[model samples]
Target: MATTFIWPFIILQCVTVVVIVLFLRMFLHRQLEIGMGRIKRMDKENLEKEVELNDRLEKLNEEYDMKIQNAEKQADSLINMAKETAKKMRDSERVKAKEEAKRIIASALQEKEKVLSEATRMVNSKAVDFSILILERVFSEDELSGLRHRVTKEVTGVLFGSDNVGELIRKNKDIEVVTADKLTAPDRKYILKMIEKQAKGKVNVKFVVDKSILGGLILKIGGSMIDGGIAYRVNKAVLELREEI
Candidate 1:
């Protein structure tokens, strides 16, 4: 009886232990599944964040490249503007120099005229008794006219060369021709034809009648001035004489 009772207790203990073991195993498996599900959710959120960050970085890079291109274009424009400004400044300086030279020539001519007038007055005072009536009567009007013509030809050639004037006419279409008198019809036509050939279009030629240039013509185009006139030649000659003195 004792042995049979002992075996029945042992069997009951074994059955309880087996039930407890199965319950514990099921609880642990559920807990592990819950943990694995949370881990997967966290991993998905991290991946989404990474994708969004990559997209933002890509946009920023594109923006940066666009900005760089715009900056480069602006820089190039600025550089070109600077170059144009510098060229304009240089051309302006050259124009100023030419004007200064003209002024110097004018001053020298005035001084020479003053000296010549003084000398003439001195000679007239010294020769109070002498008379030019005989010589004035001897030279006929026609002879005096011929002498004036010869002097005019030499003066015109020395002051203004046809070749240089022609080249200037061809190069500058928008020209300002300053002269003591109005141009003749044939002269105007010749000038227009010469300029039109180089311009390939209608030339804008402006005529200015200024007696101050004395005779011949003075041409002004853009920043350039061609001083081809009687007044300029006389002034230049006076300047050379003053320099030598």
Candidate 2:
């Protein structure tokens, strides 16, 4: 009977222990499920934040690249513009220099022409004067005395020239003859005959002696004079030539 009572008590203890174990297992399983859900939610949030950071970094890199490309393009444009401007300036300066040189050459040529013209004029004038002086020296002083006969002949020839003969014939005035030497009768007669021939009629002549004539003869009619003297002819020619020049 004691054995039988002890067995019943042991059975009852075993049942209580089993019930406690089962309750404890159920509580631990619920706690594990709650912990797993919290872990999964935290991992999801971390992944989303990493994606956002990566996208922002990519956008910033793109912006930087675009700005760098624009800067390079602007630099190239500036370099080309500078080169064009320099070329234009150089071309303009070269043209201006060429024009200036042409102007200088033209001015020099004009001045040279003016100087040459003046020099030629002066030379021509001097040459004419020198010729007159040489002629004057040929019949100067005693030389003139010896040339009187030739001078008288030349004068008669001039009086009988085509134009002069007609002019003297038209005048029909009395002529006065002055000479440095006394006229011999034959010389006077010959001179009167020459005058009458050129005048185309008999012309009255009055003669006078004047040593101031140096040599040869002077014929005066009204306001006109014909000097048959080397010195006088040379002087008159000089005066007329100078006036013409």
Candidate 3:
């Protein structure tokens, strides 16, 4: 009975030990599983945080790209604006230059006209003065008066240019004559009456005192002013100069 009781006690003790070991192993295994589950949860949470961070970084990069694109557009716009402004400036300068050139040309033309007019005036004055100098030198003192009167009459006639005042004496017409004062009154009247008979017209006389002819009378014939004086002969030399000019 003691052996049997001892053996059963020993067996009971071994069984108890086996049961305790099994329970311990189960607890340890359960603890290990719980630890692995915690590790997995932590890993998931860490992964989620990493994904969020990556998303945030991507968003920042997109924002940066948008800013860069906007900056580029602004830079291009500025460049275009500068080019347009430069072009406008250049155009304005060209227009101004053209206007200046036109003004200069106009001024030159006006100056040229002014100089031409002055030259013409000077030449005309020279011609008139030159004529007077030649006339003064060629005439004698005594012949000068009679020649001047005859010349004056011719000048007046040319101005009037009446067709009736023709140089030729015709019948039944009024006659005009230029003569010296030295002609005697009765003799002149007789000569006039004779000329009237020949002319078939009334005679009117104009008198001039002239010694330049030395002694000669001038007769006005039809359409002709006859120069019968020495002074006129000298003046003919000067008149021939008209052909040379």
Clashes of each: 0, 0, 4
Error of 3 at 83 (Å): 1.1
Candidate 1 lDDT tens digits, 131-239: 2233237767666445433443454454334565556656666787676556667666755565565455676888888855545666686667877655565556555
lDDT of 1 at 199: 54
Candidate 1: misplaced stretches above 4 Å?
A: 1-13, 113-129, 132-245
Looking at model 3, the pairs that clash are 143-212, 167-222, 168-222, 172-200
Candidates in order, TM-scores: namely 0.44, 0.42, 0.46
- Which digits, one per residue and each the tens of the lDDT, describe model 3 over residues 1-245? 88978998999999999999999999999999999999999999999999999999999999999999999999999999999999999999999999999999988998888888777556544544455456558876556656655554454344224344333555224334444346667645654665565555565545565654433445564445555543454445444554466
Error of 1 at 130 (Å): 3.9
List candidate 3 segments past 4 Å from native.
1-20, 124-245
Residues 1-245, model 2: lDDT tens digits: 99999988998888877887787777777777787778777777777877887888888889889889899889999999999999999999999999999999999999999998787566655655565466468767556555666666666566556476448655866888887767779888887887777777888889998864545677777677777755465556655776897
Instruction: Report the error of model 2 at residue 110, Å.
Output: 3.5
| Overall lDDT per candidate, in order of appearance | 0.68, 0.73, 0.63
Ranking by lDDT: 2, 1, 3
* Better model by TM-score: candidate 2 vs candidate 3: 3
Instruction: Sum up the clashes in candidate 3.
Output: 4
Model 3, position 120: C-alpha lDDT score: 53
Where does the lowest 10-residue lDDT sum fall in candidate 1? 127-136
